[model samples]
Target: MFRATTATIHTLCMLALAGCQPSSDGRDHGQMQLDACVAEACTTLNLDGYGMRDYNAVAGLAHVTSLMVSYTDFADLSELAAMSQLRELHMGMTEVTDLDGLAAFPNLEVLHAQYLEPQSFAPVAGLARLRELAVGSAGLDDLSFVAQMPALHRLLVVNSVQGLDLSPLAGHPGLRALDLRASDGMDLRPLLTLPNLQEVALSRIGEDIDPTQAQVVAQLRARGVSVDLDAIVVPVC
Candidate 1:
């Protein structure tokens, strides 16, 4: 749990320094509302834009388990290094360029990141406890990292870089559900090798697609895995 005393002190100091005053405009704007974040025992932090960049503000919340950050300019997650108990993270439409800070949370289970700049997900592959992963990026091309996540069960990938290869997902021991979208053709044969697959949804973002993709879908259906080609599956946290 968070040290209430520490958070109180920090909050008061921040408030005093900023000289926070009620705006005559009566509109909710500016940086993240710091006082509201600590009201819930500081266990869950939701930062929704407004130029919130000071990650150190929540570093004292040692027990925080779920965090959501969006529409910010911070490129890396280095400031969140102290949140070791974090389990779920929803970071979308942010300036985050790399996932190096993920190493701090060995217990993380669910991760959702989208609309990011080009970057390698090399660090995410090391999360041994991760079960569900949702990522959308035009810059993410190499997916070999998925092979290392033996515990992964559900995966959602959207807007992949053109010509993305999904060979890394073959023969996954525990994967049960998968949702993917691509603007270009990608080999879909890997889905056939997933022994535990139960459901799959594929969305074509462009007209270009492999001719054999229909056959692959049929094969998965024959094997009792539900496949939906026309449906668009969006992952959320």
Candidate 2:
């Protein structure tokens, strides 16, 4: 459960936590045809499916604490800024590039995205209260931006980032769990410095360990770190 709301889950956001029909795969919504889809989904908590509708309703809920909108086309996200109480959001497979709109939700603690584009991460760089971030995508090499998140506790990346430099995670006091099996040949040395890190899972990766990495693993084990080397590893998600 989330600290912000007892109803919200830690890993699964509204779309996955609640029962809602997701948008059909391969549906392309251009500029004009997609606004209606966005409006209906955002206004009502249930995006059950995507279709053209006439209503442009806002999430008139009293708390406005959590929301999920997936498979909708949103070129401009100015509408989301009005949700001052928003604490968690799941942006599912969106074509929206204006992610800076998320900065408005200062109370936001958890974020789960079905897609991860390059500039999409920049907007949350200053959101210090962010705790959990889970995003999946094929192309993600520079995750250095994660260092900016002060309260980040869990980071689950279900995508490949070959030869990623995890050096940025050093000294992150709140980081406890890390799941990075999709990424290959990562440097584990940086993780050794994180004092609060409790669990680390790296599975299904080709054994390409060097002497330096083995030494780091040995040190971590000696320090009581939980390491899952072989398993279908994943974080809370």
Candidate 3:
């Protein structure tokens, strides 16, 4: 009776061990199903209504290039380091205050980060391949760091900064368009020295200038730089 009872216990242990064995067949089947689901979703991604909660769902996908996360409540994008192929990133109107996690995307070209602070652009200087950058309505007072970026082409700084001196953008041959409007105390004389400047928007210059502001405007026009005057209208009726 004792031997029979031992045999029954041993048989049960063997069955348990068999159940614990890793099955390649089951793993392969699960992997195939996961791959198919990912393939279907990538081709038909509806990125409009998705919020920060859905960010984890797409973080594993390595094939995505363009991404727009505007109006989301995401304050940090540390998860984006996994996406090596990301080219364009839009984080406009979000609660993000820091740009520390952006160094991983070496292939990033265009970046639109409007309505942020001055420290937000600290990580942008590391992107060597970045071409176009549009940052507006942010409390940016200094652009001296932008001189390090060799590949920058178009830059728009409008309606936020109190005083901006663009002397750092002197020797950049790749710069084409520069828009500086409604910046309270900005001096336009430094930008006229740019060798490759083509299009410039210097609207609302009279707000910060004194009585001799016309002479300064005349100097900018003489240097072959197009200046658009932004005049204020007073209602008399």
Q: What TM-score against the true fold does each predicted structure earn?
A: 0.79, 0.70, 0.68
Estimate the overall C-alpha local distance difference test score of candidate 3: 0.60
Best by lDDT: 1
Which 10 successive residues of model 2 have the least lDDT summed? 1-10
Q: What clash pairs does model 2 have?
A: none
Candidate 2 residue lDDT tens string, 65-176 = 6655555453345666777676777664666566777777788787766455635566766677888877656666666778888689988776645777787788888888
Q: How far is candidate 2 from the true structure (C-alpha RMSD, Å)?
A: 7.7
Per-candidate Cα RMSD to the true structure, in Å, reads 11.0, 7.7, 22.8
Off by over 4 Å in 2: 1-56, 71-76, 118-120, 205-214, 230-237
Across residues 1-237, which tens digit of lDDT does each residue of candidate 3 receive? Answer: 000112244465455434433344443433443356487755222232124343565567776676665444546777667876778776655566778878878888877676555355778889888887766554776676578887788776644667666677877766767766544566665665667776666555235555444565677678775655542211000
lDDT, residue 160, model 2: 49
The per-residue C-alpha lDDT of model 2 at residue 212 equals 73
Model 3 misplacement above 4 A: 1-50, 118-120, 205-224, 230-237
For candidate 2, give the lDDT.
0.61
Per-residue CA lDDT of candidate 1, range 1-237, in tens? 000122244455455423322343222342335557666576777654543547676667776798776555545677777888899877766678778878888999988776676467788888899998877787788778889998999888867777688898889897998877662577889999999999877665334446788889889999999886644333232
- State the RMSD for candidate 1: 11.0
